[model samples]
Target: MNDLVLTGDRPTGPLHLGHYFGSLANRVRLQERFPMYVLIADYQVITDRDVPGEIRRHTTELLLDYLAVGIDPAKVTIFQHSAIPELNQLLLPFLSLVSVAELRRNPTVKDEIAHSSQSAVSGLMFTYPVHQAADILFCKGTLVPVGRDQLPHVEVTRLVARRFNERYGEVFPLPEALLGEQPLLRGLDGGKMSKSRGNAIPLSATEDETAALIRRAVTDPDRVITYDEERRPGVAGLLTLAGLCLGRSPGELAEEIGDGGAATLKRVTTEAVNEFLRPIRKRRAELGAGDVRRILAEGNARARERAVRTLEEVRVAMGF
Candidate 1:
């Protein structure tokens, strides 16, 4: 079987530092090693229905961020999820492979419910992992690169594939999780780096804007220079940010700042982050709207061709 890697981001907002440090930077390397499919999950964006305009603009903006961050159009297939109907169609049968109780137990769903803090959760939100399973299994993905929080989705995809093979003939390979080692990066306010929280530093933000965000980023309130995440989450957060951006270790940074103040750590963290983003910012600006549009158009064509082929197989298998 061919080694295929599937990964993507929800186009709910501009790609941010959390995305960059968490997984996007890793994709630059993985794309060279595996047959990578970078999906722009626009359909998933509608899970929260209030942000239609944000989703539309972000879909295009995400394409720009991918281009700016060295996601080569020639090396990887970049596709919008909504543009591929076959995958969505697969969600119907695939949904039956797993139980509603199983879905409720999924950590991802639980986290989303808690994050939204809403009593009314949409069916789309509840069933998203099954849809994601369809997305991966439809493409016959063998390797899924994701952070630890996403491990549950990969687990569910594996379960769905196993069940589908047992119910029908063997139709899909169980995909494995390629988990990252770094701790989950947090937003400026010490929460997760989320656009909804308004604490994210957009991958497309200017150097000045990025610096400004870092300045406001929550740091150790104790005003001490130590890097104790348990005692000083804010300073520890900055250390994590710097380490992730500079490709250094947080422990090393902690030792380096023997007697420095929180201001020093902040300054150093800001500089490290800005320096890291300099190239991407320049490329993001250089990637004009017309160029981004053309890339997505080509990506859409390539994606549809593959989706059509996969749907043909599904139809034949199920006697559709």
Candidate 2:
């Protein structure tokens, strides 16, 4: 069998279009070819001191988004990170292999700290890369599907795996990143698409909600619509979104909408987006709470089985 593939998302909010185009779509294809493990990274959410109530509520929402996007639990093992205690046990040994200064210097961690509203960084926040390493290695993950920005986190996982094997003899396989061809979709405000920014259109969003969000999306003040990301990010973002929905190039969409103006662009974009999301929203509405609970229960059990085996091997190798 091919090396196992591992990836996940923090259940902070409902999954959005950025996630659908960026990774979720790729995951739907990958699960058919590889032994894949998709994690609901609940533990990682608390790194920023998020309330437990919110995490619990959003976890269910995130799962529904996964199913709505066609992430079949039968094909991919969708598991909760915190459900596997062995994953936490692996974190201690992995943390020892890396230094504090190195963790502080991780670009991804630094970016999170800079953008966060917190005045002070939590130790959990600082050490999340270690936790992520644990999440991957606990599954013996040899291939990690991630975005370009997340390459650094995967690199840290490789470093941890290499150091552990060097000191204790070979055990973990160093995981490589598989980046998707899809471009990173920007938020409605022409920035990173995040729920915290209130700029994302959730996969579960109604047709009216999607239309309202796209109507208010930032666009170039100039009359004509064009696709120049460097000079006119707002217009370019709308074009990119429309292209993703309609299966055309942003440049092609730009030319098609030439001299149509921002109002025209927004109108086309709103229609394209709502049309694209119509089916996903319908499927999500069809899923009952019982369906989500049953999926999680089965996934958590399968994940624990793999995690336990990996942890036992690590313990013996480390003479613990």
Candidate 3:
């Protein structure tokens, strides 16, 4: 079996700054060294959402963001989730291998449930991790790049892969979690940065939009800037963002903006963000729906070929 990578995002919204340093940048570099399959997880959106509208539009935007971020279509097989039926089919046998109690044991799921503070989480949401394993193993992914919070899901995938191979034969390779180097980028308000919170800076945002968003970033009244995250998270968050954009350290950046106060910190952050995103913005603007559709068409076809072969092998191994 060919070793590959499987990584993607739910098409709930456009890609954001947190996504950039968290996983996107790493994926751009990984594609060059490995056969990477980027999935636009449109199907995963409905797992927690009440009404998953605008998914097609969001999926197209996601493709555009992938291209804009230098994830070359030629090297990365970027495919949408629903387009490949065989992938989800793997969930049948995969889910049967795990129990409900085991799924609840996944820490990510528990955290999400507590975060949402809702008792109405659907069955789909509960079984989401098992579905993720289908996404990974269908591509024969040996490496899954994820943040610390996502490690449990990958662990679940590893468990399912191991169990399947032990019972049905050695048909799948256990995928490893390639943890991200960057710490979690917090919201401008020093809280969670999510679409629902309206605190994240999307990659598709215009230069003016970026500046406006940064202008409102929460920062303290301290005149002398210093990188003390525990005491001053708001200021440090902006510093962290600017540092990532300019490839500098947050402490060094804090020194540069010394005594400039929150205004100067936000200004520097705005400039750094705009300057870094200029090229990516240009690329995102140049891309169109036509470009997105054609890329997905070809990618989905290629992905189908891969999924079909994997499924056939799985059937033969299981005497189906």
Where model 2 places Cα greater than 4 Å from the true spot, the runs are: 50-53
Cα lDDT of candidate 2 equals 0.89
Residues 98-170, candidate 1: write the lDDT tens digits: 8999999999889887776345778888898999998898779999987788899999999988987777778
Q: What is the lDDT of residue 98 in candidate 2?
A: 94
lDDT tens string, model 3, 179-255?
Answer: 76866687799876777788999999998999899888888888999999899999889998899899999999999
Output candidate 3 Cα RMSD. 1.5
> Mind giving the per-residue lDDT tens digits that candidate 2 earns over 240-276?
9989999999999888888989999999998999999
Best by TM-score: 3
Worst 10 residues of 2 by lDDT: 45-54
* lDDT of predicted model 3: 0.89
Sliding window of 10 residues with minimal summed lDDT for model 3: 111-120
How do these models rank on TM-score, best leading?
Answer: 3, 2, 1
